[model samples]
Target: MPDSKYAAYQPAAPYFDLVRRALGDRVDGAHFFDLVTDETVYEVLYDVPGWPRVITGRDALMAAFRGYVGAIALESADRLVVHVADGGAVIVIEYEVRGTILASGVRYANRFCSIITIGNRKIVHWRDYMDSLAAWAALTAPRGV
Candidate 1:
């Protein structure tokens, strides 16, 4: 369980685990939300229903994550490939997540590539790319396991 202060970020746990491993000792944050700047901008390159294409501010991101958890419960996040550039100011991470749709028991899987820009040891900007078709298939899966 996430601390009450970051309760809204519970959905990020799986992904954060991968990030923490990749960024080992590069950033200081016990939780995923803590690694983001208050004014952080998060952008999604692909359109996934129930998800915004662009999100600004860690608070806004928190709300978005809340909605995400309600729709899907992640089982695992892995396959991390990290690339550092510009003396650690910019990093690219590719990963995959597996989960189950809440409304149905349908399994969900998708891969992601995120380009992150850091400032003052916090994530200031994020541009994300994901397998939208795979997500849509899971979202539209037949109800009931």
Candidate 2:
């Protein structure tokens, strides 16, 4: 059973749980989509000049995720913090991903911080932050192991 306050919000625990399962391990694609509202929006901000921020709706977001599916293996969430307020929820998740690049077979390890907003028990918005230079270096540098 889910929290009573979230009863009206369709697809409650299953939605958020799936993300934990999907990213922490491997899971079916359909499961991931179940949690996202049709109008869900995602943004990735970068501080670098000339680097355009990424803003896209559900379909585009899914597409972008698909491109990285097999390219990186999301290992686990390090610090997952959640805050619920006035009919809305925000989750801050820090995670590590490691795998070989599909194109170069170079091993990579990187960390990410994602902030997700939920409304009506469905995800409405998401923003992610990561060290781009660290990601690039990890992907191209020699493996520690």
Candidate 3:
């Protein structure tokens, strides 16, 4: 449950709910607009065709996710497992996200593993890996095929 002070920013349906669980206490002063500070680094391990491997700051992160959010309407986000290490500073999460492609109306589901590091109750580093081939297939399949 989210604290009363940050309740308004609680991850609601259709957007960012996975991010909510991923943020934890950092969500206190965090919003999509002001997500990262100067030192923040967001990295994606797989070689996604049009996306970069490393992203820095709120603006860069926003830009990186813009295309993805616009392309898919998320239906559900479930955390399959979570491991906390380094005295709660490092978190590794295994999760699944289900959604539909906005343009093709095709079903899309993919599993993800993400490692996040929090400092001063804020996310400082995020590294994510996903089934890229699954994503490619979903995006490329003929509509209603």
Best by TM-score: 1
lDDT of each residue in 1-145, candidate 2, tens digit only: 2345333322223334435453432222334455565687777775433233674565665555554543444432344444444444676666555555555656665567777776665667778788888667655655442
Against the true structure, candidate 1 has what lDDT?
0.85
TM-score of 2: 0.62
Better of 2 and 3 by lDDT: 3
Go through the candidates in order and give each one's C-alpha lDDT: 0.85, 0.54, 0.72
**How well is each residue in 29-99 modelled by candidate 3, as lDDT tens digits?**
53534445677899999886678999888667766667666677778888668788998888888888888
TM-score of each: 0.92, 0.62, 0.80
* Candidate 1: tens digits of C-alpha lDDT, residues 68-106: 888888888998999999999999999999988989989
Return whichever of 1 and 3 wins on lDDT: 1
Q: Which candidate is the best by lDDT?
A: 1
User: For model 1, what is the alpha-carbon lDDT of residue 96?
Assistant: 98
Summed backbone clashes in each candidate are: 0, 0, 0
Judge candidate 3 against the unseen true structure and give its global Cα lDDT, from 0 to 1: 0.72
TM-score of 1: 0.92
**TM-score order of candidates, top first:** 1, 3, 2
